[model samples]
Target chain A: MTSTTAPVDASTTNRTVRLASRPTGEPSAENFRIADEPLPTPGDGEVLLRTIYLSLDPYMRGRMSDAESYAAPVPVDGVMEGGTVCEVVESRSEALEPGDIVLAYGGWQTYVVAPANQVRRLDPTRAPISTAVGVLGMPGFTAYAGLLEIGKPQAGETVVVAAASGPVGSAVGQIAMVKGARAVGIAGGPEKCAHVKDELGFDAVIDHRDPEFKAKLKEATPDGIDVYFENVGGKVFDAVLPRMNTYGRIPLCGLVSQYNLTRLPDGPNRVPSVMQRILTKSLTVRGFIQNEFVKAHYKQFQADMAQWIADGAVRYREDVVEGLDNAPEAFLGMLRGTNFGKLVIQVGADPTQSA
Target chain B: MTSTTAPVDASTTNRTVRLASRPTGEPSAENFRIADEPLPTPGDGEVLLRTIYLSLDPYMRGRMSDAESYAAPVPVDGVMEGGTVCEVVESRSEALEPGDIVLAYGGWQTYVVAPANQVRRLDPTRAPISTAVGVLGMPGFTAYAGLLEIGKPQAGETVVVAAASGPVGSAVGQIAMVKGARAVGIAGGPEKCAHVKDELGFDAVIDHRDPEFKAKLKEATPDGIDVYFENVGGKVFDAVLPRMNTYGRIPLCGLVSQYNLTRLPDGPNRVPSVMQRILTKSLTVRGFIQNEFVKAHYKQFQADMAQWIADGAVRYREDVVEGLDNAPEAFLGMLRGTNFGKLVIQVGADPTQSA
Candidate 1:
């Protein structure tokens, strides 16, 4: 272990959680290892950051596998990648200054050095810095692009989203409401369902864990679903399939339920039935990654999202854990739908606050 | 059977094929029965017609099953529904005159009566009367709408269509080529594949039956496929899936291979794998019924297709059966991939043609 007496500078040491092994099912603590190493120095046009809040999302499960994916897999012995809100501790560029709070992709580390252009400076007075790692960042942008671009929710139509209390789903429901569409939310329990309906103002919210979940969903949207922003594909999707209206659009954003599966579930293959409905209904089922629309929609998204957040047209919730060591367990819980809101790890206190 | 001799006037008799039973796998001749009955006089604003050509399409297979579909199932003893080209023998409305050839949904019959406004008049001088039942009608419209509206072929891109020798598939390839996109066609055998490439002018063609079919597809498309007009889904779809480029668009018009499936195939469900690729590659798979775009694009389609036919920019072939007795067998053969080109039953010869 490094001595605490060492000066806290770019050459000083830091600790990080590394990918110890690839996960086959629900990841275990054994899949990650914590290691301490010397901090990297800021080169020209670079800055050193001290992590404040790290965002944990479902997409991370994809990064742990060696399978071919939109993005490259995290290598063994490397820090697990993620979005973070950090403070610049040292700057070698004219664009940034030390102690500035900014949004970064510094991953599961206490400190990181990255090119200055890669980080965006966050205004502490405008909104909480932690939000830049959640609602004002990737999750919010994902909901905006997937819904408006693909879902194309027209006025008076019903739009349904699953995992409804999470950052993405909650934002999707609120945005649909803003667009003058009916929003129906599906969550795992009564509490989350209540949060979606009473707090987030969804037109209807159903607990998917209930035995009568399918029936509830059917009754909730009597006019049938026009846009299903698919985030969880399992029983939730199976129920929604039959109720899709003609010309229905499904913007498939994620499939969290099947992510940790070691092998395909035993089945009577449902592909034919799915295809049959698609043909008869003239449905449009499109899958998308948020980054694909960034060049065209990102600037608009940032401006609109910031306004929506400021005006309370869009609301977000966060479940913050205090220490880096707890991320592995919190992430596992998140995959199992145990998290109540967006899960974030507060790696350390904001450096601007006096100890 | 009723007596064949009857007055060839307002009280003339009509003969029709009816659905006797639902089919199991391939429809058998026993599942259909022909009936002869007296035809009543035309009502006010209705016209009487003599059937010249009746179209036989794959969609008829769905009508033979009791299972629910986009449209209602054919009643147990009703005339098998179909599009036909007919000559007006009598008229009670200003829209028609005797000897006029028109497009009508007159079903499988020798003579029938319908409101004059329900049919579109066809000029025999502009093209063969039988073309109204094939290339210049529903099948051709299906191809035009599905490709241009949903597939959105761009110049210099590669467009792949399965069932390439079939009516819809052939048109899709031709139109893609006309729009400056490279067309790669997939058909069942060497003869059909040759016809697709040589006769239709597809840039490249491959036989799906070849053991090296997938490898051949990769070799033919050095640039990955940008548009996939999906009409035949099965092993053919499996082969084309991995070859799809980023942001590829698939306009799924049909899935002929899975229509007769009695039960789901044994699993290691491939659905998850399919969804994963959709997210990672950002591919768009949309299912459509062509009629959705008809109100906006139909007039343009008819004008453009007629010009293409006249200049040889588009060519069409038909497999016509001599009599209605062979219609059931021909249709069954078509569903099994044994018939080549558009399948039409020649119910009767044109009275205007001198023999």
Candidate 2:
């Protein structure tokens, strides 16, 4: 394989979704703008990538707002930020060649030009190419590192995670199972709950939409929760907190339930009560971004996760929304817990997957 | 010295302070009752301890209530629980002899018969015997383990602690300084603020009672707080949360401010926002009791603290009340931040002190 750059053709163009405006509470379609522009040329040490699949996540809702976060928010009229699986169309670097599939932060766009070193090459023979943006990518690593490092689920301990049908939470539960911990999942609907319990192989699954959500959570975790992979905050947190055992751990990665919240809820400011619980229970509540562990754990995560997938110890589902045009609606649906699995936008046709 | 048992005299009586009633909010004189009981004799492998100094701490306030906590609540009409420095009046084991000073959980009584192995003997030649209940014992060890193990103060980083003039906070600041970190202290009044800054040698000290406390805290931690030894919670926590640096750690030891609260305060529950801050800043908030680190870090703590005290890098002050009869009053004062330093009742004469 050799690096090659194709001549810029006037017929080729890039379609992109940009942030039109910031949302107040829940985002509407008016917050996004679809535009078409001429394809970018590959520079020295860079590769021109055509996006195959764009991931839609709850964290993107956070990136839409200008609130203080671990990552910078997408600016108005800028390409909405996200992870994507792309194919190298034109390369000017020795590290990557034309037709090579790679995982890149090409965001909500049909095409991108990135440094070859910045994008990681994905071998299509090992797994589906789309899994690069789902199970074998950032979301999977988020669950892997946060659960193992902060949550530290010991054998026979109960590990609970909400959004069990989604990428991060699904992986959290399954990986906890792999480590000999009893994985209890909390999902919003009966179908998702069943999938999480039957297919994902979690020890227990509770439907968060049930009126007895708290009681169900309590029932599911009879021995009490030792590790809670906190992805969805709000009432789920309220339910899980009291069920936490002594010396329990909370690996806080995302709070999707509160991401759309315009303001804090009315109450007696229960932060102190939470602090009181943390003190009396000897709990550890740690917030982390998965990237913090990449330098140390990414290689190990890839190897262990690959093995788990091979042995059928781990399973993942993808809710693929067709076309770049459907991304905005799909993303909104994901925030509302409508998406069933690792939600991704099939931006363009995949060459590796046989039709 | 040899193990010996004193003859129990029929005329000798033990004076005790028992929990008459549980306090709803602030404990009062009515909550405690002073009584006389017959002296207990030492059994085989047991020793009789005559309370010389009774330590008054904020945690005792929690034990007074029937609320669920890390430790069980004191039973109604039971002896008020506390740590005490005692003189072994009779020993039936080879570990201790008569007149040997030891640290014991003797409660609010003048004398207690405990298993000889349970009490820890203190060397008066190394430090003051009263220190067994203060700087050289539990309080100091709490500061050492919580700060070093959990807080993990790094060189040139800023470390903040509240109740700076009190036993735990004072040692926390000094140890942070010993670790080459900048120490910021928060205390209630001018006297304590002065002592924390001038005498205890904190890098900076703030008067928490000041109307501009939040502003002062921000001003004190110019580079932002890398480690916060959370000894006081409530408004102090609210102020410190915004000032925490990314990847900061909080060793949650005590919530002195909320110990007496009968009910939670009103309006706009901020637990989510606190979680949001934790997420954005990648913060670690862990709660712990000092005894958790006893097996792993206590020996190192003793060696390191002894050297620091010897090298003049650490200093402590004790506010001794004249009699056990004054303990309830002194304890009430300590809760209100009226009593400075480590509050203790001199139950009997300290023969080791050359007075």
Candidate 3:
């Protein structure tokens, strides 16, 4: 609802990353195409936006496939859907005007024109403008909602999150600390693991890449895991299962590790083991999308998250890739755990911050 | 807590069925041995009990093995543990004297001695004395607590329960019906399925033995399952998972189908599919033992169940296998879904009913 306006730029060219093909397993650079577009004029109740930052996430991998899921797959030759921080370059509504910075689902695009009511106006004074699409946006909301609402970590209880250096997992671990619980973060290698432990202030950090990963996990969680914030599901999940204590809660948020799996691994079926463990241990495994709790918890999440950031109780890191041309490669890299922090693309320069 | 008693009968010898050896998979008659011993005498605050009805449940099978579980494995040469409806033969405490019918953990024995405070005195006038260990005791409590507390079947929602002819499953279906939800039962044979749908008044019933079971399930659950009270986990669970709706709740109380298996079945593991469906559908899968809810729900369960039985809003059937000597065969049969209803061993004469 905060705004500052300057003269409108009447002429601007837009660039978009479109899905070029569907992926069978992991996506590749060939699956995306960059296209140039003319400036879109605002219609009634609409605002024309110049995208500043575009978020690249593992979920985008799901949208590229025509598999059965909660959401529909992105069609080949369609703009890849994503969250972006944008500035209003033109306005045709009473609600918004030129130069206003706002958060919009502008996809992997340099410009977007949307209904004024559809975009959330953001103030640069609250935090950095790009945080609107990073920590203070969907990923931050995901961790806040899933952890507190479902994981329900108690004082001194151990809460484990994989992909711990990323946006959602990092926020999850820090928020677990904020809530009086012990946070154990699991990341890919030594660097990310070190960042999770030292910089993020997680009580313990384990590298999934270590040959002694399982044994190290046992050493780290002496009392066993009480809450596992599941972001990656594969070998990491296999390691976490046996370490779960009785009545442990699993908030299944994402299955990043399994998203690229073309077929299930061969086995003496472990599904029965899962059910058996669930039964004998009296555990709770709940899967959820952040929006499920949004109506009930969003306002409170915004207030609490803003306060946590303001008080230094919470901090975040960003892996901001440059140029709209690099989005596809960055996104593919993110799914493979190449990004160290919240991955975002600087689609255009931020008007509120000096270059 | 209520009681009535008469003079003790002092001449009876005790007969017990003990585990002769643990079986690799399905238990056979060779795995059990019957022994004769002198009746146990009450000491101080203890009472001598004559087990009238011995409940045979799927959970009992877990106790027969050395495998790890929530409770300790019943030791080799140990009497098979079970819920029993007993008649107090002698009491040294102020709680009761002789001839008071009660519920006790008397195992597969003809007579047991226990602390008077441990046995719960039953009111035969309110419901049959045998009902204490059948529909009105642990099995009944399992259904009420797991279904309502965990599954949380909303009015008009569809609830599917397998092994639907057994005590736990039947009670689950009836309780789902009581909560105004549509109950779909899955049993092994046409006869059991008929009993489930016709006598039990379940909205629908499918025979898992049918070659067309998967399609039949699809037809039966037109709205998809909102709550799956998982009693038999194997192909039954395989069929149920895909049919689960968004936000579906699964109260996993038992995995009777896999309890006897020594090793897991060969597979391209379906655990990934389980996790995937959970994420995509936003489901809640919780496993619990009924006793966990006893302290909170027992008082209300007793009152509500008694009222339901009195009003004919609920009904139950008993599959009574007479005498302690036949306990092994009846038990092995019960595990294979041979029993039509609540399976009980008639270990002693019921004073309130003629033999």
Candidate 4:
């Protein structure tokens, strides 16, 4: 398609969501305030871009709290930081043209002025542009690096992951299967469970919501679990503990279930029991963020994941909301396990669509 | 000192303490009953040995209970299993000779008949015979393999270990220092704490019994803990958890404090918080039994430890009880943190004493 490069001045209006207050338990609509602001211009070595897709992930919950964490908390009255796929509209640098699509950390805003070098260009010919914020980006890399580096699944072993239909867990299960291991996925309901087993090609899928979930897991894996990719720790983790085999590896990636908990759960502390299992089973329970392995594994992941995607061995699903105004509601529902896939907001549409 | 081979008779007398009953909490004198029986003769390819020193460790506490564990429960009314340094009394195989000191899994009994291949012969001239049960055997190997393999301490990093005067913890701290990492030792009393810091050359030491234990730990480690060699689980662990640095490695070796608990301790369930820290800090909490690394790292450990001992780089202390009748009480004391150093029962006098 032929495209004309026009120097369109920065728009007068910019939509943004400000962090109204720090969340005490579950974040609400009141925690975010939608406002309009004057658009920002591209400065030296910078580009003015409009967000096409804004990604919502579980790690954002940690950033909302004022508690000590690996990363600093999102301050009150600031836009929530997130990954976004954007189209470069105005560039002050010689490196980029007006229509080039790139991956950006633009936060929850319709328009942002970011340094050109800070954004990575994404080719429209390879995969969908929105995927740069979903499957082929942070979430996909998280699963790949954490599983191979920490989980280290061997062939014929059973690999189990909770939140099986989400971006990271789905990638983890698929990658485990590709490595010749049996992937057993645990999800919240039958639909996600079915998607995990049928679409994602997991060997087995169990619904954690079922009353007989533990028994089902036991029946599902005749050989006990060798690797458990921990994402949603709570009752699901409790159920998975006794089922882990000797020398089993648990790559603890997240604890989405406990993110909203304001107080410690009621008594009969299971810490001793957990320690007992660790000693008896000789288990390796490692917690890791993907950034630790990015230096060593990122290049390999790009090559392998791209090949897997092209060969039809790996598949992904995305759940998209229509507007920037809907982001807060979409994110709140995501924390409640209402979103079916990698949730993304369609802040704007592709300019190439009209060509 | 000329050695004479003792004739093995099928009807030789043997005395053993059987498990009278499983203890509810702390083991009492009534929990053990001494019995007299005829000694077992060596079969083909077997050797008979008289126990010299039986090693007492926290793991034996698990064997006393009927609960499930990594290994099968020691059968009720059976002689308690343990590691021992013994002298061969009768040899049916050419591999072993009478008066040869060897390391054996001979249990807590006066005499044992087992295959010659099951025991490793030790050189009495090279080192003290009891060293096989303390600084150069299973406990020492446990410390070395777990710390180096799982903990992987880098230079300038801080390593914290509890029960610092015990064989494993003492070795771990010294090894961390050898790797150029700061070693912080945690023990139950002032005397043991002093021994860990003053004698063993640990960078810092904290008494877990002190009312300001946590405050003292904070003062000791200006930089957060990088490796926590977890040997004692309880309030000591609770204090250490928050102080762990990002990407911390925890080698979960033994939980001496929780071994005697009949039920879970009363408190708010801390598993969620543990999982949260695991996720946020990117910690690696690995539980291991030393036998797992025997094939991979044992040979190197023996060479390195032997040289360290010979050069006085690694020193060990032993608390010996004089008779077999005192073993149960000594072992009970070891579990309760009453016994210092490596607890060993001297069932008989060393024949080399005459030399």
Q: Give the whole-model CA lDDT for all candidates, comma-separated.
A: 0.88, 0.91, 0.89, 0.88
Q: What C-alpha lDDT, on a 0 to 100 scale, does residue A319 get in candidate 2?
A: 97
**Candidate 4 lDDT tens digits, B1-355:** 1111343342376667677788888777677776667888998899999988988888888888888888776787888889989889999999999999889999888889989999999888877788788889889999999999999999999999999999999999998988899999999888998899889999999998899999999999899999999998989999999999998999998998888788898879999998888888999899999999999999999899998887777878888889777878888788878989988999877876665
Model 1 ranges with Cα > 4 A deviation: A1-11, A351-355, B1-11, B351-355
**What TM-score does the first chain of candidate 2 have?**
0.96
Task: For residues A1-355, write the lDDT of model 2, one tens digit per residue.
Answer: 1111343332397878999999999998889988778999999999999999998888899889998888899999999999999999999999999999999999988899999999999999999998887888889999999999999999999999999989999999999999999999999888998999999989999998899888888888999999999999989998899989999999999999988888889988888889999999999999999989999999999999999999999899999999888888888888888899999999888999888
Error of 1 at B212 (Å): 2.8
Every candidate's fraction of true contacts kept comes to 0.65, 0.85, 0.87, 0.87
| Candidate 2 residue-wise lDDT, B112-221, digit = tens | 99999999998889988888888888999999999998999999999999999999999999999999999999999899999999999999999999999988899999
lDDT of 4: 0.88
Model 4 spans > 4 angstroms off: A1-10, A352-355, B1-11
Docking class of 3: high
Which wins on TM-score, candidate 2 or candidate 4?
A: 2
CA displacement after TM-score superposition, residue A216 of candidate 2 (Å): 1.9
Compared with the true structure, model 3 gives a TM-score of: 0.96
Q: Where is model 4 chain A poorest over a 10-residue stretch in terms of lDDT? A: A1-10
i-RMS, each model, one decimal: 1.2, 0.6, 0.6, 0.8
User: How far out, in Å, is residue A91 in model 3?
Assistant: 1.3
Q: Proportion of native contacts in model 1?
A: 0.65
Indicate the TM-score of model 4.
0.96
The collision pairs in model 2 are: none
Model 2 spans with C-alpha error above 4 angstroms: A1-11, B1-11
DockQ pick, better of 2 and 3: 3
